[model samples]
Target: MGDKANCNCHTGNAVYGLGLIGAAIYFISQATSFIMGVLGFVKALFWPAFLVYEAFSYFAV
Candidate 1:
């Protein structure tokens, strides 16, 4: 007998990927320079953190 653990993480990954793409597009579109575009891509990678921080801030009041 084999014990297999079932995991369902693909949906979360898909959502995160979509959010990253959307954030990258919005950030890059507003950037005026190549460096800012690069920064935007970096920022997109941390979008979840920013979202959490903003949510906490909004609710902290």
Candidate 2:
């Protein structure tokens, strides 16, 4: 039972870490777009990639 509790705690931490990583990626992408202006077209590519990544990550978790 104690081991199960520990495993649950670790899973929670992993989830929290994933959320933070996703948020950081989103903010960084937005910042890059703002800074690059029209050149942000390249950054636009990242949104789809990010979405795919998020979907995979969520399902994998």
Candidate 3:
């Protein structure tokens, strides 16, 4: 009766997801003040925007 589906893929996905979440938490905590910390967390949630902006700024210079 050992016909159960293997969960290796699910386990791998959970590990990857947790790692990304930990990185996001670290990114959000880099701010020194209450307001900035909150803003940083929001920024982390939408980090692609910041990435694009930084890319543009770097290229524009």
The 0-to-1 C-alpha lDDT of every candidate, in the order given, reads: 0.93, 0.60, 0.70
Mind giving the per-residue lDDT tens digits that candidate 2 earns over 1-61? 7777665347766765676566556566666555554345444435556678899999995
Prediction 1 global C-alpha lDDT:
0.93
Query: What is the per-residue lDDT of model 3 for residues 1-61, given as tens digits with 9 covering 90 to 100?
Result: 2545543457766765675576578866787888887876666566656778999999995
Native RMSD of candidate 1 (Å) = 2.3
Taking all chains together, the TM-score of candidate 3 against the true structure is: 0.47
How many pairs in model 3 have backbone atoms within 3 A of each other, for residues 3 or more apart or on separate chains, i.e. clashes? 0
Total backbone collisions for each predicted model: 0, 0, 0
- In the range 1-61, model 1's lDDT, one tens digit per residue, is 3445655459889999999999999999999999999999999999999999999999994
Would you list the rank order by lDDT, best first?
A: 1, 3, 2
By TM-score, the best candidate is 1
Q: Ten-residue segment with the worst summed lDDT in candidate 3?
A: 1-10
Better of 1 and 2 by TM-score: 1
Model 3: lDDT of residue 30? 89
Tell me the deviation in Å of residue 53 in model 1: 0.2
Better of 2 and 3 by TM-score: 3
Cand. 2 TM to true fold: 0.38
Worst 10 residues of 2 by lDDT: 37-46
Q: After superposition, how far is residue 54 of candidate 2 from its true place, in Å?
A: 21
Q: Candidate 3, residue 54: CA error in Å? A: 0.9
